[model samples]
Target: MSKNNSPDSIIRDITREFNTIVDSVSEESNFIHDRYFRFAFADPIRMAELLTLFSRRNASLKAFLDTIDLSSLRGARENHSTDKHIGSADLVFEVDLKNGGTTGLYVGIIAEHKSDKDKLVLNQISEYYHHLFLERKKDVPVIAFIVYNGEKDWNPLTETHFADYPEFYHDIGYPFKAIYLDVGHAIDDSEMKSLSPITLVALTAMKYICAKAQYTAPRSYRQVHLPLRLSA
Candidate 1:
């Protein structure tokens, strides 16, 4: 039991360490207005630490890679200046997964941190997903995840898809799939138990702060729940 708890404790410790790393290396910070975003993606080294922390904390994501292999997995923060939006993904990179030494491939995971009180994250995630699609081929599985630290209890209203957004009227709008991981929705240990390792890592990351200040946190975790179901 003690050994089992060690990793979880380590995850929390790393969160503190990451905070320190960000404070020391971040170019600028405004805790009252941009506390969350500053904590997550402002520093490249902090971002790398976060990726490692999440991957290690979640068993499923860890199982997917079997072990950490920096030679294959690389993470970075890209400046995606688009006419459609102002913010870019907090973390973006290729993760190479080896399945029984027979199959090895790299899949992309785009992570966005949302920690505000507003619920306008749907549009942000939709835009990011579409942008990813435009840059990558259609065959590429660019999985999306939005981590939020506010509110709970969600049932996604997906029938009203991103197209329904009033701002995305033209052909410039991109379409892509996303998985929502809402930390607020984890009301109890059971729901947390139902969450996938990827989702678990996402939630753990969100508990700290948002990746960008421009985006609003969704009402719940409805946006990125697919990865949890897929992991199951």
Candidate 2:
């Protein structure tokens, strides 16, 4: 493989690119934020790393992440259904389970990026789940995540009412509960220190760009970004 095409090189390049963008931005753009969010997680390895880090906080998710065969990670096909009600997920991945045996079993990880608050975001996520369920024939286990970088405090689960009949809520499971990561509040300096380069850059960029006021990267992050930029 070419030196520049190596995984290490790729991570550095992405970090540098993110640094360049975040350093120069004067105003926030949802489009730019969404694009960068998708770009950072486009690589299966990077996506896996981010999810694995996130799984550290949730025991059940960590167990599931441990079962994944990272080598088998790949981007899932984009939704092309003409149905107006259905929504496409920002990033979706399919990875085989380590104990799948001869037939091979896989699970889906869906990530949705939010640059702004949307009360109906869960509805959109539900649509994505429905679409994936139809395409995968409901056999694949799916886990969903919401990466929110908006300035406003928003929690879809607590803010939105899922159903009128609370009793029937447990019965309807088409859309799984998403683990919400509010970039502004979820990550801290201690957590940042242990993150992989790609995860560090991605989360740092999101936190910096989405802040209510002008923000600066921590000294450690700047030190990390410098080497990446020099290498790139």
Candidate 3:
């Protein structure tokens, strides 16, 4: 196959195209951020690549990703109910996994983009789990990814706690754990170089907006040209 037609090459091409779209947009708002994340990760291949790259440091997550059938990756409809106070996740995905040829094991991935510190972040994730549980009518495993691009050094899992429940901390256990990715730190991480072009560009743009500082692409991403063209 020609070099341009290789899998990695194709990914790069798509990444550039997406970047162009992002560059076309002028104003930045929560709606824009949500749309950008949903549009960028809607593609199963891109979603799989992102999960694999970010989950590498975590053994459990890495193992889970390994079992996922990439072909079976797809966006899942969000479930919402005002009566139950359940809210939708920024992005939800379902992927099938191989389990010794047993009945298919489907996993739910919840991606939440946080550009600021929210003390209620855990509660937000819990709502997602609750909604999914009700929708599936079964105990399905979920992996919540909190993608943070804010300037503050925040770790919800460590910094936040249930309200008035210090005594119940030991009694309470959540069915899902969150994987936090701080974009500022991620940009400096050498491992970021391994990320697909689209993922890298998205992170770079987020950091720029959140920091409100002069935007300079990391050296590794310079090949793609700094200040990548974005579109609405």
Highest lDDT: which candidate? Answer: 2
Q: What is the lDDT of residue 88 in candidate 3?
A: 74
- TM-score between model 3 and native: 0.70
Residue-by-residue lDDT tens digits, candidate 2, 90-122: 887788888655457887778888888887777
Residue-wise C-alpha lDDT for candidate 3, range 1-232, written one tens digit per residue: 1246565665555565445434533444555565566555656777776777666665666777777776788877663233211247877778788656557678888888777788888788888788766556856778788878766788887763555767668447567867777665555535556565566666666666565555533323334554434321
Better of 1 and 3 by lDDT: 3
Give all candidate RMSDs, comma-separated: 12.0, 5.5, 7.0
Clashes by residue pair, model 3: 21-231, 22-230, 22-231, 23-229, 23-230, 23-231, 24-230, 24-231
Residue 139 accuracy (lDDT) in model 3: 65
Q: Model 2 — which ten-residue stretch has the worst lDDT?
A: 223-232
State candidate 2's TM-score. 0.73
Best candidate (score: TM-score): 2
User: TM-score for every candidate vs. truth?
Assistant: 0.43, 0.73, 0.70
Model 3: weakest 10-residue lDDT segment is 78-87
Candidate 1: worst-modelled 10 consecutive residues by lDDT: 24-33
> Local distance difference test, per candidate?
0.45, 0.68, 0.64
